[model samples]
Target chain A: MNPVARLSSTSTGQAAPSGLTGATVATNAAESFPPLGIRRGVLLGLAVFAVAAFLLSLAVGSVPIPLDEVVRVLLGVQASKDTWQTIVLVFRLPKAITALLAGAALSVAGLQMQTLFRNPLADPFALGISSGASLGVALAVLGGAAASVSVFGRAAYLGDFGLVTAASLGAAAVFALVLAIARRVQSVITLLVLGLMISYLAGAVVSVLIYFSIPEQVSAYLNWTFGSFGGVTWQQMRAFAPTLLLGLAAALFTAKPLNALLLGENYAASMGINVRAARWWVTASASLLAGAVTAFCGPIGFIGIAVPHLCRALFGSSDHRVLLPAALMLGGGLALIFDLISQMPGARAALPLNVVTSAVGAPVVLWIVLRRQSFGRV
Target chain B: MITHRFAFTRPRAIHSAPDAPPPNGDESAIRATDLITGYRNGTSRRVVHRGLNLSLSRGKLTALLGPNGAGKSTLMRTLCGLQPPLGGTVWIDGEPLHALSPERRARKLAVVLTDRVDVGYMTAYALAALGRTPYTRWDGRLTAEDEAIVQEAMRAARCEALAARAVAQLSDGERQRVMIARALAQQTPIILLDEPTAFLDLPRRIEIMHLLRDLAHQTGRALLISTHDLELALRYADALWLMGGDGTFVAGTPEQVHRRGELLRVFADEGTEVRRYLQEIHQRWTTS
Candidate 1:
């Protein structure tokens, strides 16, 4: 190789004739025209909507108090009627807050599962967590364990606390089994199939417990399974709120890794993410969330699976920094609306919470699946 | 014809000139000694290529060319420490490759695999920014420096325009470039790619090959690519690692491989006439 020839080539080679350069990428320029501020704007809009839904959930219940009285009671001001004050302060307010927390918890859990599995169809209950909670509730209510305690009693009564604790323990057990399976298998579909199998197994156990129990215990379990946000008292909420907060914190912390996992495990590993540790964190966080919610609110469905898709539809971005908060706000808002509907606007009879959730959530999920659109995987 | 032929010869030396630096210290070259590359079957390890000694130089594009199932991907995986070698040791710079922690290994070597990742709603910018994973905090937030590096990487890969576009919506060529941009963002001394242009059209293939070649010389990074595009590999790569079916490997300059007749011997069974013609043209171009 001639040194002079090489020196000359070095100068001329620096510029290739008529080659594609960074400036020629006009295809992306068309789509990139939308300002990124739209994402922040969308998040702000959802936050405002969430607050409105919270107020609406409080004001439009069975008593149908005006928005003004709801605000007055919330601010500790004397409202027009003491009955209205008592209803808003004692009954509906706690229920609305429960709905908000439960909604956020389940929805974020669903988002994690969908990202981890790289499957759009995945949700919090896909691993049979709800079934696990149901099994625990069946054992508590049908086994005559919870019947001994009065609702207002002290330590003597098992009551809702026993049911909540049992449900949580049951969810944790199922999650543990899934975690073990996840560790052993590398395939996403295999883990999902195993989860479905676990769900069936738990459902079979719950069926057996139902068949052996008395008619009264069966009805009690049935009512609990109807999934109402109203059953959570201020006392129960103290335990429920912290558990949810822990889970939400874990979820938020893993948002970056969740973004990496979107590209699949191999890609995630190349990016220096400890793929196994990330998976464990996601599993533990998701279990803590879905398990705690099911424990407190009887496995309220729809908002968990549907709210993430709703956020994606609105923001059109999958970056979890944006998606996490968006899902939280949207999930809470959706839950508030569903809980409001469950209150039965003009009628005395309240609808089951799951009924309204399924009515709204099922259609969105169906639309996503029917379109066969890619949710990060083919 | 004389001037036209001479024009092609000059670019080769200019591209090859960056190879003079010694690959040591933090700018470590990958060296494998008597390596056995393959997968595990039940309790025992299945050997694909045994007793392999290969060194990928710093600041050069080394193309690993072999037929289907010739153990190209397996060899690369073993070399990169993605999979443990069945028998031998791999050294990165001067340290044992497998001895390094995963985080440390990631900092030293970055990879671009052929696996099509579904990034959902993440933009090209966010995807490329993930290359800073080794340097970012536990929460994976990018610092100002990390952000600047990511932007520069996107620019070098000719994907700065794609920073705002969703990865899912990009064309195959664009996506491949973005994947390379991510590897660039990793800021590793050594970069490995498996079938980087498998799905790309001819023009995009040329662009990627040219981009990778330029990246190796300009950035002074060791780049090892496993590709079936023999023509581009011959033209762009400074060195060639030819894996033969008889469990033997040959490494040399493209001209030297042609001169030694190793290129014809290994590639003889398929495309014999084309390979012969390429050798004839290569012989004339060099000797003239």
Candidate 2:
């Protein structure tokens, strides 16, 4: 039998001490954690929830296709109407897929960041990856107007692809800078503060570009900042899906190092982990995930920061082996649900993705803080 | 005195190994030669201690006692390979410490640090299981043998009752035992601990000291601990490494060093009252 199961069995076999109150014994038993089987069952339930959320996302958009038709179109059967087929296959499917991928990628990245820094508040963007991407988008949209550069004219010809390339390059630039600094610095806190400074620098540069640009260019930058999942198209998925999958794979590979890190870096090194190499891998994977999502999906927020915390609470453990997969599914499911809410089912007008996410995410974050204060648990 | 009571309770049979020689002989588990320890920042260097030689032997508990700023931490860090020694070399089990790969070094040496392990929500069992990292696969999945060793280590540390409890929820004493359990689970021939008794109460300190001494005896592993608990160290430790903070170093059995008045001399700067109190305590214990 597995160690957890064996432990639980032994604990169950022992009678409570006579002096202990019933309430204290109950609390002790609860704190022992649910058995391994139940935790696995929770993961299974999360998988089902993710699938159901994806289906709902497909069926409940502004066009409102029926669930049966959505399933039929998914299974390669003919839909009753051609428009429904086009909507399901061409539009809704890609958007839903983007939401799923973006959510999972950001969440796994966030989980890594939280563990690496040992800060509960840390997210993928804590390293200023999204800010770096924003600077790229801002330069593409507003700097082009200010400088009137012909190089940007050609970039404009590539449309959204040009914007994505710019954002990716910008994020990569920051990632490189951070990695360079990480090599020299001994502490993660130094890296975190440097990241914030880099973010401010980028934000300041973008602000200058915005000040010089016309209203149309300014709005264009603003729309990107609002964030959206629907912006990614089928052709873009060729680049988007594979990048995210690679990032997620890298995250899964880091389970061992991350577990060691929970005891802190010194302890991790004592355990034979090459601390420097492990930190590099974690930063690289987290940067890649956050950067890629921001490039394709315009820096979606809340899902990255919130999902990992939610997973930790629900799963009742900090073991990366459990948290990584849990975050992947729960993050994707939450993102899909938020995306559905953004679509506003019966209304033609859609809310900005960030607006819906922040609206819901802020409260969840508040609840977590309150709960932690009351329970003295992280 | 409390020391005499605990001394009487100690299992003296474990010290009856016929072939075992006194410490500082050929049975040294870790040997440092002409060692210099310090920190370097860019172009500037600050040397803490210089040209020192030390050896820790198997089947013994050695207390590394020193006043604050006496280079105790720097020496410990250098010995564990956490920091590079400015000069000289350290050897573990006859192999140069710097030459060994991290994996090999981990297998040969384990450490329990003073750093607070705020591993939120991790069970003691799970935390102890991490000691199997060097032996386990890349994913750190513990094998059946690894699990059994972990359970045994916890049992040996007298923390088997805390196996299912979250480490975060453990009392300081319980947590210290769990951390010791982790080091024991590593199965290294040598273990180093920095201030293992700090932040613990009087009874807890004695309990931990007794446990460490017992562990060293039972497992025949060399154990070195840097601590501020002078009384406990004198009572429980087999040997003592005294860093006098004035470029003087002394090593010998606790009784030998005390007889030479080296312990009193090392802590002389603590103030006259502390020195006089230590002398009184020493007089009472020795006479009793």
Candidate 3:
């Protein structure tokens, strides 16, 4: 620790490859690795937002219960059949939870994508994942005219497991196709363009379906495109939570290999990773996260494309060990805050969630582009 | 006899010492022989080299050299399990290398390929800690033992001073050491480097080679490196594995390598002097 000791220590390196030690077991280098102050700060901020949003989601609505009453009900200290408690626990909680889960899923998917492509602007929706979900949703909503594939021997038609499953299948299909294209194409820019083309192709299909459908079906389909957190029922949540968690977990497990992959496939393979399997898992997890959220919550936007960049800006590094957790908390908190605003308080005119998301997410994105200097290339 | 001692400025004795230790009593180190590897793109599934035999003498430095595409990189990659063999086998100790689990293989062999692929924020120390991943749990939290090894590896790699810098922000030479530090933390018996000095500037490249030499000599570990710098490889390496462009690989002492005309064949186009002077100048050119 002293200057003299430090001087003596440096001089030893010139003499030999003798490691700086006395052979006694020393402190682990990894533990000694300093933690990022910015990341720790961002994490604290996210925790605050999560708690505030959860309370606001319970307290803000047409009923407008006191914050204390909402807290009490959540803690089970008081009982009520009042609309406030009902709305707080069942309607708003489900919607709030949906927003949180959906946001985290999309953000993590986007983070994985940007890293994989080595492109700054890559995101889940930007890479055709949202469109894949849209096609699946359109097929389900407009299928009233035809024989739909029944999930459990009966067609629920408007919103069924068949539809959600179809969305996942569509997303998986698109992801698989994109990955193959990514492999064949040498340039990252070309990959981004190919993804956009896929999105347009899927978007065209959805528009054509909307054009031919009955007015009622067309209306339902239109609402889905605008995006919402209100459609997830308890039944939907039961299935949604597990798949999303599994997909998130899969993405998390790949953190080490994904870090190695940034160098190239050959480099990753040399480190003893199963390159083909890693790519497959990457596709599977991204599609699952994007697909399920799209099917149940509608085709949300802005969150996936922007949250990851924001996370990087906040954390100031690309390490997934930190990025994944930051994305989870930040995405979930932001989504909850957006959902709370979606239900217009005094005015009867509630805004679609996408409009609110764009207002909030866009400025930050613009700021990122404007000051791309602040956040250097990863 | 294998003379694998650290702190050697230059050996007074010619070749190995008259008295050298036996290969060793440990039955779990790497021993390679007659490895053949190559690529299979499109129509051609060309063999890199056939009947190219070499032993990765335990506790010694082994340098593999040849021209750009003479398959030195391919051979190193194959040894690391990234590429597959066209013929012959590579064994770890007395057992088949591939027969071991990937985790087990990681425990025995650590590799530093010539590419930078990290996409996340990591300090030099943290990157070095990843070397302990095979020994750690699935969560990859470093245990007491993992921690001890990582620190020692960092010291050996001489990356302690840069421990706090983000890997993304480090210069090319420093980043290379960070990676080598990570591999050292793995504490594998066999370490393979593929043109580790390629991107490094002169002094940094020599420093890396010196570090590798130290690790092998001190730990009784096997070190194999692929490089285009023939003179440096010839001078420092205990054994030379040379691959010629005409699909021939021969391994022996530096004199044996030259005697086979393998060095001349790979370093020159059909006709040119295989000047020891040219070798020195070419090496100086890289450093300069």
Clashing pairs in 1: none
For model 3, the docking class works out as: incorrect
Best by TM-score: 2
Q: Model 3, stretches more than 4 Å misplaced?
A: A1-45, A76-81, A114-120, A125-129, A141-201, A207-220, A246-282, A313-319, A365-378, B1-34, B41-44, B258-262, B270-288
Error of 1 at B276 (Å): 7.9
- Give lDDT tens digits, candidate 3, residues A1-378: 422133235435675543233332333334344642235766788878877887887788887888888888889766354776677778877887888889899888888777766666677665687788777767776754544453421333434565567666667677777767755554555657877898899889877877777887777667767788887788888988898999898888767666656556665554555556666566567767887788777778788878888887777666676777788788888888888777768868889988988898888778877776564652
On a 0 to 1 TM-score scale, where does candidate 2 land against the true structure?
0.90
Best by lDDT: 2
DockQ of prediction 1: 0.25
When 1 and 3 are scored with TM-score, the better candidate is 1
- The DockQ-derived docking category for candidate 2 is acceptable
Instruction: For each candidate in the order shown, give its overall lDDT on alpha carbons.
Output: 0.78, 0.82, 0.70
* Model 3 chain A poorest ten-residue lDDT run: A19-28
**Whole-model alpha-carbon lDDT for candidate 2:** 0.82
What does DockQ give for each predicted structure? 0.25, 0.24, 0.21
Regions of model 1 farther than 4 Å from truth: A1-39, A77-80, A140-162, A180-190, A209-219, A370-378, B1-28, B143-145, B267-288
Interface RMSD values for all candidates = 11.1, 12.2, 8.7
TM per candidate, chain B: 0.87, 0.90, 0.81
Candidate 2 Cα errors over 4 Å, as ranges: A1-38, A153-158, A376-378, B1-25
Report lDDT (Cα) of residue A163, candidate 3.
56
Q: For model 2, report DockQ.
A: 0.24
